[model samples]
Target: MTGSSHPVIDVRDVSKSVNGPEGRLDILSDVAMQVNGGESFAIVGASGSGKTTLLGLLAGLDTPTRGSIQLDGHALEQLDEEARADLRRRLVGFVFQSFHLLPALTAEQNVMLPLELEGNRAAREKARTALEAVGLGPRRSYYPAQLSGGEQQRVAIARAFVHSPRVLFADEPTGNLDRRTGRHVCDLLFALNRDHGTTLVLVTHDLPLAERCARCVQLQEGRLEPLA
Candidate 1:
């Protein structure tokens, strides 16, 4: 599905707003974009510029106040919460700055989660394979508290890719690590993406990291503009 004719993500004339004590505050307005299958792009923006909001909507985790979003041929606005969750499980993976691993679960258990949810009988073996791919096989029994920041993030990455999602949304993937460690984690990310042909959508404020992406778009004033 990497180079499929249909776009993996499509946003059209989308807007999102929420009521504030002062008034209605708009997060995004009239934003539209298309992410081609297997393409990698970063949504770069300063704080409060709505990059994460747009990513959330595109990911079907949040909905637009107006307009439409299509994810892998399904209309986001049309799906109910359950359907949206199903779609996400089938086609999407996520990595966050905080490395949202379950504190009690070991690396292998965390990686097996998605497969277990889908009732996969081979979840244990598959999880081991994913951890190996991220060079975490030896740490499969390690708890999050026992691993370094980069290792925890690698576990998160392994969990994300274990399901072989078509699109992977990463928010500040390298924000919490040292420069050298961040570079190594980034290398693993793009390498796995290349291996699996997953379309990568990363959100970050780091200009250098953004420039490393295949393409980047800036989110400004509640709208998107391609970086020149």
Candidate 2:
């Protein structure tokens, strides 16, 4: 995926704004970026600088108010919600700081959900393999409430990567863990990305985490800069 002719993520003159009680509020003003497949890109910014909003737009979870976003060469703005979801199932994966695993489902079950949705017949086996990759094979039967924070995050990682997405968007992936545990999670994140050749886009405030990426850009005043 290296030396790719086209970027996996291409955002052109994108902007997002929301209606507030005070009237219209502009969150992100015209910003553009290109991220190649298999490359790690970090988005660092101060709180409320719209980093998360931009990530949401790039992932097709939200549409841009102005301009356009191209993910894996498909124009996001042109797709309907169902089409966007279908495209996400086929190409995108997500990791969040909150470790958004279901409270009721077992670890393996959670990991298998995405595959099941896609009608993959070997969902259970693939989920087990994903669990093994994250070193949670023995804990696959445990539910989220029964696991520690780091372990829960590991399960979320397993769930995210189970279907082998071409791109992974992680938002504050290590924000909930202690230093030692955060480092371990970070290592696992990079390992998963490397092994799968998945494009990595991370939004974080941690300098060390930002440094791990091949390219780091800061969002300031609703804009992206190579250096903040």
Candidate 3:
């Protein structure tokens, strides 16, 4: 399938608020950002700064209370949950800090889940290749509990990249790993980005990690400011 020339993610004047015990609390306010195809962008902020919220909004995992978000040229605000989920299945992949793998599934099984969900006939072969790419070929049979934190995270990364998604959203992908392991994971992520031309939108608090991205946007009270 030919890739779209339009920006993979476009957010304009987006704001989100929630009801607090006392009153309404705005998590994000008037935030605008764009991530072009194959670009690596970072959202950096302190805890409670709404970085994750912005990432979720950009990935169409959550809706913005106000403003607009266009993902792969489709207006997200107009789509219902099912439609948004369909779009996500087609264009997006995500890696989370927690390495959310199914405990009952082996590493290969976890990677195979997405391909199987898409009804691909080569799911096992594809899953094997993906695990091998992450240097976990021998551990393909290991379940999440059988692997170390770094290994589990690598499996998660493989799962996200298995389908060669056009847009990848990572939320503090290395947060659970040690410094050395985190560096290795980051290297793998960038290598995949280079080889597949996947657009990467990462939310992180790690300064050096954020610096590795092509562009960095900092969020404060849900507003974006380009990092100098």
Candidate 4:
């Protein structure tokens, strides 16, 4: 899927800071990284180490206070919020720790949301295929509340992959599951990544999970420390 040597995601001299009650709080500083197309990258850190913050920036959910980021060759800093969102819809998918499924929607509907947002007329059929891919075709009618933790996560995974985005951002994807379930979810994630050639950027506190990525880096005191 990666046809060129250019990076799919690039971050250069990025920093983020916010004004807290006491004073300015620096959450990230001087971060630089590149993730190529079809590659798997991991960011690991302790609590308050800015892992999530960095993930948000990388995914264009937030902007760095200084420096630049490019996603799929688009300069995120040059895009407005609306334009950034449009770019994300066209190229990005996300899976999160809590599953982030809408309780009111059935599994199929949850998986169809992305396509529906894009006005895709075949959303239902595409969603069915995605659910089947995740081995949840038989459970399509179930709501998040009726499903187990692992099942819900699988549905979330289905939703994330249904659109075949160029990039997938997973933040603590298995955090709420038991060890066995976590392992299963992790396997499914990597399988999708490999099979679909999606660039994967994962943020995790689970070291074993981090080790599974092709490259890994740690965020210590808001700075990137390479691990591999």
TM-score of each: 0.97, 0.97, 0.96, 0.97
lDDT of 4 by residue, 36-95 (tens): 889888999998999999999988899999999999889998989999999999999999
lDDT of each: 0.91, 0.91, 0.91, 0.93
Measured with C-alpha atoms, the lDDT of residue 65 in candidate 2 is 94
Better of 1 and 4 by TM-score: 4
Q: Write the per-residue lDDT of candidate 1 for residues 1-228, one digit (tens) a residue.
A: 245556889999999999999999999999988887887888999999998899899989988999999998899999999999999999999999999999999999999999999999999999999999999999999999999999999999999999889999999999999999999998998887777789999999988888887779999989999886
After TM-score superposition, the amount by which residue 175's alpha carbon in candidate 2 deviates from its true location, in angstroms, is 1.0
Give one digit per residue, the lDDT tens place, for model 2 in 25-111: 899998999999888899999899998999999999999999989999999999999999999999999999999998889999999
Segments in model 1 whose C-alpha atoms lie over 4 Å from true places: 1-5
Weakest 10 consecutive residues of candidate 3 by summed lDDT:
1-10
In candidate 1, how many Å is residue 119 off? 1.2
- How many Å off is the CA of 47 in candidate 3? 0.2
Better of 1 and 3 by TM-score: 1
* lDDT by residue for model 3 (1-228), tens: 223356888899999999999999999999887788988889999999999888888878899999999998999999999999999988988999999999999999999999999899999999999999999999999989999999999999999988888898999999999999999999988888878889888899998999998889898777799886
- What order do candidates take by lDDT, descending? 4, 1, 2, 3
- lDDT of model number 3: 0.91
